[model samples]
Target: MRIEIWADVVCGWAYIGKRRLEAALADPAFDGVPVEVVWRPFRIDPTSPARSTPLEEALADPAVDNALRVCAPGLSPGENRTRVSDIAAAEGIGPRWGAAWRASSHDAHRLLFLAHEHGGAELQNAVAERVMRAHFVDGADIGDRRTLAAVAAEAGFADGAALLETGAGEDEVRELLLIGKARGVATSPTIVVGDRALAGAQPAEVIREFIARGGHRRELPDEVERLRHAEALLDRRDPLGSLVLLRPLLDAYGDDRNVLMLAARAYFASAQLGRARATLERLVGDTPDDSYARHLLGRTLQRQGLAEEAAPHLSMAAAMSPEYD
Candidate 1:
C-alpha cells in the first residue's frame, strides 16, 4: 500500500497527524501490511519570509494569520496553540511551539526532496520526521539553509548543507508542490491513500478505517458541484482553498466561462494580480461583451497600478451594466 502525505513542517496539526498515523499503522490489525509513505510539500504560508520573526510574536499580530487561523477561525493563536499542544500531548508528541520561529518551508521541502533522491522513501521519511521535530520541538530556524543542513546531518546525511548548496532539489520540490495543488490538497496533514483522501489531523481510528478501504477509486464530484464549492470557498475568504479545487477544473475546463471567472475572482482575492489579470483577459477576449469580466479586469489592472490601462475597461463595464458603475 502507498500513502502520500501533503503537509508543512511547521504546521502543528501536521505534527499531530504524523503521530496519529504512526499509531494507526502500529495497530495490530495492519501488522503484515507493507505501507510506503511519501511526503509531499504543501506550503501553509507560501509568502512567509525566510526567517524574520518569532512564531509567538507573529501569531500575536492580527495582521499575520497562519494555517491555524485559516483552519480554525474565531480562535486566537494562543488558543489554537493550546488546542494543538493538548492534542499532541495525548498522542505522545509534546511540541514546544512557543520556541518555534515563523519562516518559509521551501528549503525544508527541498531538503526532504534531496533526501528522497539520496536514499529513497525511508531516508525521505527520516528527514521529514527530523525536520518537523527540529521546527516544532526544538524551535530550530528551519528557513536557514545552515540549520536545515544540520538537521539533515542529524537525519543521517553528513554533508547535508553542502548538498543543499548545490540546489539539487529545487525543481523537484516545486513539481511536488504543483502535484499537491493539482490534487486539490488544501489542508495540511492530508493522507491520500489510494484514490481516497482524509484531510486534517484525523483520529487514529478514522485513519485506520480510511486505510482499510484499500485503493478503491472514489467517485469525484461533477464540474458544476466543484465550481459551486470553489465559489463558496471564495465567499468564505479562502482563495487558496478555492484555487486548490479549481486547479483541476482549470486544466479540464480551461475555456469554460464559469471556471475562468471563479478562478479569476479567487486570484484577485488572493492578490495574485498577474494570474487574475491573465484569466480576466482571456475571459474578456472570449466574450467581449462580458461586463463583469471587464469590470474585474479593470479592477485587477488598477490594483496593479495600471490606472491608465484600466480606465477604458472600467468605462466599458459601466456602460454595459449599471452594477459595475
Candidate 2:
C-alpha cells in the first residue's frame, strides 16, 4: 500500500497526523503490510515575506489562534506555548512550539523535494520529520535557508549549503504544490489512499480502517512522469532541457492539464513570456478554480508588464489559496 500525505511543515496538525500514521503502521495488523509513504508539499504560507514575523504576533491573529486551538485544544487566543508544548510532548515529537515557529515553509519544502530526489523516500521522510520537529518543537525558523541547511545536513545531506545556494528543487516544489491543489488537497495533513482521503489528525483506529479498505497505490502515468522530469529539469535551472521534454509532450498532450502547466512553466522559466502567457491563459480558462494556474497566469502577465490585467488574477489566486499569503 502507498499513502501520499499533503502537508505543510508549519502545520501542527500535520505533525500530529504523522505521529498517528506511524502508530497505525506500527499496529500488529499492519506488521507485514509493506507500505510506502510519500510526503507531498503544501505551503501553509506561500506569500509570507522573506523576513520572519514575530511568533507572538502570528499567534495573536484570530485565524492563526483558531488553527492552533484546533490542533491543541484549550490553547488561548494569545501566546500559548505551554499548551502547544504539552501537545507535542504527548506525541513524543518535540521541545514544543515557541518563538521559532514563524516563517514561510516554501524553502523548507524545496529542500524536502531535493531530499526525496537525491536520497529517496527514507531520506525525504527523515528530512521532513526533522523539519517539523524544528518548527514545532525547538521553534527553529524553517524558512531560513541556514536553518534548513542545518536540518538537511543532519538528515544526511553532505552539501546542504550548496543545494540551498543553487536553489535546487524549487521548481519541483512549485509543481508539487500545483499537483496537490489540483488533487483537491485543501488542508494540511490530508492523507490520500487510492480514491479516498482522510483529512486532519485522524485516530490510529481510523487509519487502520482506511488501511483495511485497501486503496490503489497512486502512480503517475508515463506521460505525467515525463512532465515531472521536465519540471525537475526546470528546477535545476535548465529551461532548455525542460522545454525539450515539455514541448514534445505539449504537442502530444496539448489539452492535458499537467502537460500544459509544465509547458507554461518551461516557457516562463526560459523567458518566453508571450508563449507562457498564451498557455497560462488557456489553462486558467479551462480550470478557473485552479489556484496555481491563476497564480502563474498572474505572474506571467506581470512579467510581461501587464500588472493592471494581472492584479485581479493575483488577488483572486491569493483569496482562493489564502494559506499562500
Evaluate all candidate structures by whole-model CA lDDT and list the values in order.
Answer: 0.84, 0.79
Identify the leading candidate in terms of lDDT. Answer: 1
* Tens-digit lDDT string for candidate 2 (168-253): 87777876776565456778889998878887778888987887788774587877766776777777777776777676687888
lDDT at residue 141 of model 2 (Cα atoms): 83
How do all models score by TM-score? 0.66, 0.66
Model 1 gets an lDDT of: 0.84
Predicted candidate 1 versus true structure: per-residue lDDT over 1-325, tens digit per residue: 8888899987878888988888889889899989888888999888788665787777776657655666779896678778877777788875354347888999889888888777878888889888888887888888988788888888897766788898888866875675566567889989998777999989999998888887765456677766776787677777887888788899998988889899999999999999999999999998999999999999999999999999999999999999888
Candidate 1 lDDT for residue 200? 93
Report the lDDT of model 2 for residue 309: 98
Q: What clash pairs does model 2 have?
A: 47-324, 96-137, 100-139
Candidate 1 regions exceeding 4 Å error are 65-68, 95-99, 216-325
* Candidate 1, residue 183: how far the Cα is off, in Å: 0.9
What does the lDDT read for residue 155 in candidate 1?
88
